[model samples]
Target: MKFKSAFYLLFFFSAFLSFDGVAQNKHTFEIKQGNFLYDGKAIQIHSGEMHYSRIPHQYWRHRMQMLKAMGLNSVATYVFWNHHEILPEQWDFEGDKNLAEYIKIAGEEGLLVVLRPGPYACAEWEFGGYPWWLQNISGMELRRDNPEFLKRTEIYINRLFKEIGHLQITNGGPVIMVQVENEFGSYVSQRKDIPLNEHRSYNAKIKDQLVRAGFNVPLFTSDGTWLFEGGAIDGVLPTANGEGNILNLKKAVDQYHGNKGPYMVAEFYPGWLAHWAEPHPAIDASNIARQTEEYLKNDISFNLYMAHGGTNWGFTSGANYDKKHDIQPDLTSYDYDAPISEAGWATPKFDSLRAVIKKYAQYDIPDIPAPFSTIEIPSIKLTRVGDVLSILEKQKSVQSTTPLTFEQLNQGYGYVLYSRKFNQPISGTLDVSGLRDYAVVYINGEKVGELNRYYNNYTMEIDVPFNSTLEILVENMGRINYGPEIVNNKKGIISPVKINNIEIEGNWEMYTLPMQEAPDLDNIKKNDVFNVPAKTKQLQGKPIIYEGVFDLSEVGDTFLDMENWGKGIVFINGINIGRYWHVGPQQTLFIPGVWLNKGSNKIVIFEQINSELKSEVKTVKTPVLNKLK
Candidate 1:
């Protein structure tokens, strides 16, 4: 039978004790007799992985309910480090980054949680959740035994535990398992040129450290099925990550875990990530159903890598490189076509997966929630605020002998402009040796050819005029969060702003444009901040902050249609919704109703390209997510 009274008593008691003394709370989850046991009963985990940083704070439960409706038993999430700690000794867990709130919501909805507190989480995230400032530490080495890295890692882990550690099932919270150093087996060995043997030692060390720090819940490791030797720590549970080939994967797990019971497929690829220029990858619903059935039939457990992939707001989207080390930046809309849509709506894949999972789940699947509707803004005439240069003149600038990284300048996201003047006429090759990601070159306030570090385009031939002003605007499209390259992801022009292999000398002015949201439109023209919308025309090449008003009859979740616009970001009522690119696959940004007012609403657009566009920004129920950049 059902023991509701006993459960409620235990839950309330845990809550009472948890508030007073977190360490006093106690619950148990362990492996016994070849089965995963929770509260003295064996249970199979049908789970999905979603990042709270990707989705908004308000939609956490809506997404959890969506996960439950899809017939998953538990929710898995990656606790991104950079998202929480933007700087040393500082943290932001409020709003969307609130990990504790998300976990409690999952528990309230009758779902369990698996927390992946990655000192490094390569979920297409910038620096793989690593802070950009770590590079400034003289002897800092990440994902290793370096003292500086270890010390900082311990501090972050300790800080995280204080926030959500008490929420673990042991303390009446839903978190059941905590992962150790994500997917380390593949990258660590390759990066250090060491064999898998050393990887085992490193993982064991990391796992031991986590244990010592008091994460008493079951600890596990996740990696590809083929990279078994690389990622598996001898004592921790070994989970495979793949979309196809289940039988061999199980065999590999058995071999690694010493033929242990309770097999796990940690990262099942539901949908693929989209790079700027590549086609969005959509998997067949039939394939998803088949895989779910196969795993259930064999008594195997799995977690879809992205049950609901959300947006990568700001400059947090990452890039991938070839053997040549050219970057392929991922699109901002993570909207991985999972069973749950990015806007938290059900899809055909959800229906198929739900039907198949119903046959095996001991608990009844809940009814699906209706999706939030959309609204239209007939037209929004965005008034031009100013260009990057004009905005720069107002911002605090530092004259440096050399260029500074984003972290060095205490800037987190957005673009950086490095400016210098050449008195004599000089025309040859312009070389920015340490161009971290992408750059736009200009001379004498005129545009020049662009360069992208992702494709190894570093040097360019430019025609410089006499007494020309040289400006190199660098955009950290994203940082490489995976592989050996992730140790230190410092943004912007790292070294000297050079020209033709010679360092440009002079009092160099640096402007940091970590654009989060535009200032109040009425106050914009400290320089030319307040120009009438109807009269402003002819915007220069520099990025302009465009603003206007749109009347709304009612508020709901809507997609900002950008079919004809260039790449930039959108803010509504001073809330940063997300970024939008001319790139196909994600032509619109999701704007939630919670951010809108009843009648008059403000719309701000930071257009990096052409300013001319349709007078009205319309909203549609459908999203265009199949096109490439």
Candidate 2:
């Protein structure tokens, strides 16, 4: 028995040598005879999913190290389209947006790559990873056979390949496979209006786009096991997602690929995503351990959906819809209850999975790296600088006969203000039909009530006087990232406004407040005049921007406790950290150490409703993920 164990260890060590040595030179990675062949030798790929855009650039190496330590040989990542191309003809690939640098760093850390460059990645990303500008293009029908959408997609694919094309396996880089499109099979089932041939043709065009862009790696498609008939690309490997039944997965792949081998689970869930106002989702550590062991025992390659889910930071988080929750926007933290916490600390799930790998993995596992340090900050004083209503009036506005959607106005994300004056006194049902998300109705700058789309609330009773201005401040919480409704996710008002069932059209002023960059508090004039009439009510129901400064002797990652504050977004040193609501489930926003300075640092908040008028924020060493309203 001892001799047999020694021989097995020697055999794996020699196989590792051959794999590592060939990676430096040109290598052949293919599927043949029921196995994944690397230089004509069978190998199992142990990969984990992590997005480069979601994590800070400075900590990429550290996160990759964590994956390696967990016994993962390969790292998979989705290249978000909107993250790279903010606007049409305006592409950003430097600094944190650098893809080539990220891939090179992964290779340096001794991990192979499986790239998922999605023109439409439904990873709870804004607009399903489609650039907002695409909605403005004439004749644009996304994720379809529309020429306009395909033309723009082709342009983006070509430009992206120019940046990381040489990193493919054929070019002596670590990249092994490239995914064609993300879960098109599920979309096909949802959108039955489009013929199956069109869906297949659209997918084929996307695959062609990737190949034309110079990706010579093995191309593949991923879908749920039952939908392989709709999602599988001809002559391309089909992989399963969220499948635990290895037998079912193998049968599905075999049925689609004519009984070939080299089966893989593209997205195996170790943990699930959490949303605001919902219980934080968690998978038992022991259950995950059993699953990991099952995969190893079956010789099946699988990638953990999110080995380390990071923050969604800024306005990039997306929304989902179902019969249960009307429109559930994802929480700011993409923690996903993953094996690695949002702050880069390993959880019990990590330990259990690592133990399984140590016992069954053919290759040797690396030691877990030291965890990152965190610090707590004392409460810092904040003061109201200016209210959003007053500041918004100063910006330019367009006069329209009817309220315009964010896409129609050519504004991507953020808040939009719609204003109109009533000539005659009117009181009754004040309803806004086709409201994209949330809106605060105001009469002469005083808050009357609010309509939240998440709850399907769009009507309210109101009493108005003659010659009073009626304003509706609408916020684009996030666009739908999944399901058939994503095609109609136009922000702001999509329909018309009505009073007592009478349409209020014409002479409307619409202001596009994208909030792409945080306001420069030092330059903006401060306002001492209060908007609320009550003496105790300071900026009640008013959108106010508060500014504060704190000094940090040493820099370390921390969580800003926004439990006391109401719904708003926080910015540190002019960088938009993320959004926080009093609704619960997510009571803190992560502050990366890299974003902090050693000396004085500035913080800003765009508070939409401050009933308590709280003017301070504290940083804690630990996160509060389960706090509820």
Candidate 3:
């Protein structure tokens, strides 16, 4: 009798998971006569969007298990073009970005895939996920049908499809649907540079490229209901994505995917993205349940915009701007107040949403996977190992009549320092109206004042000494990912540094400080000059590299409390985890267990502003994401 019961349970599970099996026989899924029929059987796409590049590879299974446990049947992800192709003609697909491996692994977990391979995925990702070198292209207008941009976009899309095209459902893999270009209506509708036909042509071209590259899965395009008219293309399933107002969404869907029947909310935002120096974006867990229930009650197919809002990791975080042109640099912690937090632990939001899904999907949900471990490590003693001045001694310098931007210097990400010597003594407001972002003004390597793009604090009047060497260190915090301004979002002192509205005339020395990799700890530990200012407040205004070493009997994930610290980037064991600032909202840096060691570990931080307190770091069990501006 027990054996018979077990067989029945297995059969029931298999029957309920038919959507996954839909790929097994015909290898084709279709939406006809108002139903998404798989093997002629209707199936609901209970899905969530998670990026493999955002989450650590080691925890991929853990997160997927969490998603499945939520009664979800499918997963969606975006392929970031800039991440793989860092330089011109060079590419990498190994490690976390292995598209084929990520899809195969999701299939192994019994979940179907919905691939959103965007040559332009604007998920608060840097440059809307376009490589920096693309800006150097002559007459290149991105996200349009310009020949140069199109040629490059096609090259990247084709190369990426070659990696995962065979894995589509039609080809006997878990991938079922592929998205054309990301929401372009709200963007292109206001563009004065590109023509309307070019926008329409580019939209069609993206789909054509996908088909030519062997993606036989059903194709779809997504946008907010308001943008459907401009963003959607003919013959493609148009999907709506936004937080609430389901009534209007349904009406819009009816007009577009109306006759087609099955519709999808490709990006359902449970929580929103927050920027540094701003209030944390927190949504009530109850609201998450209510909205999710609304989708289910209407029998609408939806995917959580972010099931697990993992870390931005490294220098990949992007920035955004408002109508006022206020630049808001996104906090490094993508924690997004998501159901699964940055530390990969379940929150109340997860529990609330799970109950809704269980009732709506009518599936027997499994036990939640054991929560990932977290530990509070002992205090780490950090020593100032290097100063910005010493590090510049051995670097190459660019001399230009005007201060060149990062793109002009063939540089991307990280910070750049512009130095110039003024033989004439002048006193006036140093007009840095052309400053792309933030800069620390220095008189002979000493910090004077800072000009910021966020608050438009771009002018400073200071005394000028004769033959005084001036140094300005500018950080490319992030480029504008979404806006009419993206085409010109180059970083650093983009134009010639001017004094009193007149461009300062002088030969400039430029240093490229793209901190892609961590510096050698041995060299830092050997240098003692960096200790001078740390011990005394005299020269604390310059950027300093603080190194720390600690031994651990065992290693587990922990959050580094950076509440007392200032703006800077953190490196653990010679790997950049991302940036941190003493702004409201995210003040903790997640140190993953996968990046830690049991024996010994090295940490280096390049701090732009010195913490008022001693150079100290503490590991905490939880993250503080509720701070208001």
Candidate 4:
């Protein structure tokens, strides 16, 4: 009787695991008549979107567990091409970029995976995730049937598949579906220059690339409801993005998916994305809960666009194009007003939505884990370490008759210093042609004026005596992530420098300041003499590097309050956390505890616009994401 009881218990547990979609055995995941089937059983994919590139690897398991606790059975992620391959043929999959490890963690947490590996993932990421080097390729047309683009894309997909392709459900991995070419229908609509059929053909080519690269599971395309006609592939499944109406979803899927029925909302927004100057976007928790209930009741599978909106970290943020703000660069903190805050804490929306999910979840939901605790640090005073010129002295400069773009210089992100020595005193309206984003003009190390592309301000007044040096520091805020303008998006001064409408011709010195990592300031201070100012004062638009160090007995996640500082990038130890701007909205940069050391930790700030009278930064347990300047 005891043996029978043990056997019965074992049978019951195995059945429960299989029914709950937790069993890791090789299973068939298919789309039949628009619904998903796992091992011949109908299943609803309660999934959420989370970028492994955005979240710290140390906390990936925690975030996965958070999603599981919210009753999600699946997790979706976009494999950013630019992120994996920072440079052409130079790939990085170790450390935080470990994509396979992230997916395995999701499976360990009993969640299926949906892979959206876009050579162009417009998640407000840099260049829509296209490597900057692609622009340097001759005749490289992106998202089209261009041979140059396809050749590189095929290479990228094959390399990516080798990393996570075997993890598909057919191979005993969690990945059930793979997406091809993100939102191509919307892109085609925006770019009227390209024919509709060409866009569709290009989409088909990408889908073929995925299959050839060894993706054996179902493939799908996601676009807004109105975009399905152009976005959907003939044989592949179609998913809706941003469609709240159940009727609209069904109609679109039926219209596009050969009258089939496995409908899924690929990107249901719990909270909207936040821009730099825009008000924090928030959808009421009740509204999300209501929509969720409707989805569950109607048997519509859905995935939260951002279950946890993580930080953009470093120069990874992208900008948007519109009539309102010409080049609206996204804030470094991609808080997105999401269910999980930038620091990985669950919000009211998470709680309320989780409650709704509990009712429909096939299995018991795990208890939500406690959010990570934050540590506050005492104020640390920063010293003026060195100027940009001092740092440039250590690097090589390219001499060109015309100013080159960042790509021309083989530089991806950060600032480029364009300088020319004037033989005679020159005083006139200084104009820069094709200035990609922002520039700070200086004459003999003194700032003269500023030019911003967002406001379409390209010309500025300058009066410098003869034999003085004129330098224009151009900053690539971010590449345009969406729209047709991306084809023309190139950083730095792409044209000739002009004075009073006359093009100034001569030898120009270009300095590359790609701040991919923090500069060795300690060595610079030791080797070079930095004259300390007698008193603290405003930077007067002069870009300066400030360095500070603080010792910690213990460390945890914390927010570095940058209210007192100005527009610049912050680096902890040698790793760049992200950029900070005084222009309101995001006043703090989230620093993960794993990135922080228990001993002495160094902080470096490359202040361009604003710096406090007292150069200092404070740490807070809570974030100041909503605070706008």
lDDT of each: 0.76, 0.84, 0.79, 0.83
Q: What is the TM-score of each predicted model, taking all chains together?
A: 0.91, 0.95, 0.94, 0.94
Q: Model 3 compared with the native: what TM-score?
A: 0.94
lDDT of 1: 0.76
lDDT of 4 by residue, 396-466 (tens): 78988888899999999999998899889978889885788888888887777889887788888889798
In order of TM-score, best first, we have 2, 4, 3, 1
Residues 69-116, candidate 2: write the lDDT tens digits. Answer: 898878899988999888887899998889888887777676778999
Q: What's the C-alpha lDDT at position 517 in model 3?
A: 87
Clashes of each: 13, 0, 0, 8
| 10 residues in a row with least lDDT, candidate 2 | 13-22
Q: Candidate 1 at residue 432, lDDT?
A: 80
The candidate that wins on lDDT is: 2
Alpha-carbon lDDT of model 3: 0.79
lDDT of 2: 0.84
Give the distance in Å from residue 436's predicted Cα in candidate 2 to where it truly belongs: 1.5
Query: What lDDT score goes with residue 315 in model 1?
Result: 69
Model 3 lDDT per residue over 1-629, tens place = 32223222322433333224223533446677766655555666778888999887888988888988877778899888988998976889998778777787787677778888877888998888889888889999888888898889889888987787777767677788888989887777668577788888988998898888877778888888888887888878888887377667667777877554576788988888988888888888998899888777666778898888898888899999875646888888898888988888888999998887766543367778987678887598876556665577457899898899998888898888888888988788898877878888888777788888888788899777999988888888788888787777888886667787778866888898888888664554345345533553544777777778888888888989888787889999977899987766887899888899999988888888763535567889888766644
Please provide, for model 1 over 1-629, each residue's C-alpha lDDT reduced to its tens digit, 9 standing for 90 to 100.
22222223323332322323233445566766666676665666778988888887888888988987887778999988888887897998999888888887777676778899977889898888888778777788777756798888888888898888778776666788999989987786567666556566667777877787778888888888788777877778888888367678768878988786668889988788877756888899998899888887776778988999988876678877666756667777887888788888898998999998776654557899878777766566664465556666567787887888887887877888888877788878888878987777777555676777766888889877888888887887888877776754788887776667788866788888777655565655555564644434544555667777877778888778887787677788887766676756678777777788888988887766544633446667667887665
Q: Which run of 10 residues does model 1 get worst, by summed lDDT?
A: 1-10
